[model samples]
Target: MTKEEREQIATCIREEIETLRETVARLEDSAKTVDLDQPIGRLSRMDSLTNQGISGKVLAESKRRLLGLERALANVDDEDFGHCEECGEPIPVRRLLIMPEASLCVDCAE
Candidate 1:
């Protein structure tokens, strides 16, 4: 990839990592604030617990993506940064723009 392209991808990844971190922080705070012993009814507490579970799952996925983005940033200048890991083919720039952390091409991802 060209130097400019690599820089662009790195920027995108960094921005995404920042956004994901903020979201994960917010989710963590929300999870912490969930109170089961409040004056709310049983159904309300159950609903809160269910929402907490969903938020936890989403937070985990976001953190995983954040890690992936950080790895992409670290390898932004690697010779194979934009290549498909499974096929050793060039991953399209458009795809890379959409998913800066992707390591597999569309066909391999399927």
Candidate 2:
């Protein structure tokens, strides 16, 4: 891929990471905003906890994504970004655009 294209992909990943971080922060803030046992609040608070749990999962997934993006970017620097780590062939640019963290090309992945 072109250098500009690679930079654009990196920018997109960074923006996504920032957005997920904000979502996680908001979930945490909402989770802490109410008491857990008040009559009008019990079930609702539980619901908040549920949302927080989901958000926490998203947060974890986002963190994993950021790590992968870092590795992918490093691969770019090392001139190994577009090659499948497992089989040593070129990875399609389309696939990389769709999933920048992919370490294996489609054949290897399958």
Candidate 3:
């Protein structure tokens, strides 16, 4: 990829990392607000627990994505940043735009 394209992808990845950090912070705050000891109906507690579980999973996924984005940003200037690691083919710019963290072409990923 061209230098401009690599820079663009790096910018996008940084933005995504920032957004995910905000989401993770919010999820952590919400989890902290959950009170199991407070007097509440059993069903309500169950619902709260269920929501907490879902939130935990979402937070985990966000963290994972953040790591990927950070890795992509770190490698943005690499000679083969926009190439498929498996086949050594150029990855489409469109795919890279859509998924700045991707390191493989569609065929290789599949």
Candidate 4:
């Protein structure tokens, strides 16, 4: 991909990471506010905690994706952004368009 296109995708990835961080923080705060000692509170807290756990997991996954995107941006800075790291071949534009964070080409990924 072109440098301009890479920059645009990097910007979008950063924005998405920021949004996910905010959501993760909100879920964590909400989970903490739930009291677990009251009669019905225990059940409610359990449910809330479970939901929070799932959200937290998703957030962790998002963070991983963000890290990958950061690395991709670094690759752009190094002038290797569109090349497969493992094979040193040009990664398809379509794949990069769909997943800007990709480090491996389709063959390597499989």
Worst 10 residues of 1 by lDDT: 1-10
Question: Which residue pairs show collisions in model 2?
Answer: none
Residues 35-93 of candidate 1 have per-residue lDDT tens digits of 77789998989999999999999999999999889999898889989999999998988
**lDDT leaderboard ranking:** 1, 3, 2, 4
Kindly provide the TM-score of model 1 when superposed on the true structure, using C-alpha atoms: 0.94
Q: Any idea what lDDT model 3 has?
A: 0.90
With candidate 3 superimposed using the best TM-score fit, by how many Å does residue 69's alpha carbon deviate from the native? 0.3
Q: Estimate each model's TM-score.
A: 0.94, 0.71, 0.94, 0.73
Error in Å for residue 29 of model 2 = 5.0
Which pairs of residues have clashing backbones in candidate 1? none
* Candidate 3, residue 10: how far the Cα is off, in Å: 1.1
Query: How much is the lDDT of residue 34 in candidate 1?
Result: 90
Model 4 poorest 10 in a row by lDDT: 34-43
Report every candidate's CA lDDT. Answer: 0.91, 0.74, 0.90, 0.73
Per-prediction tally of clashes: 0, 0, 0, 0
Q: Give the least accurate 10-residue stretch of model 3, judged by summed lDDT.
A: 1-10
State the lDDT of candidate 4 residue by residue for 60-92, as single tens digits: 786677677676656665667778889989888
lDDT, candidate 4, at 3: 71
lDDT of 2: 0.74
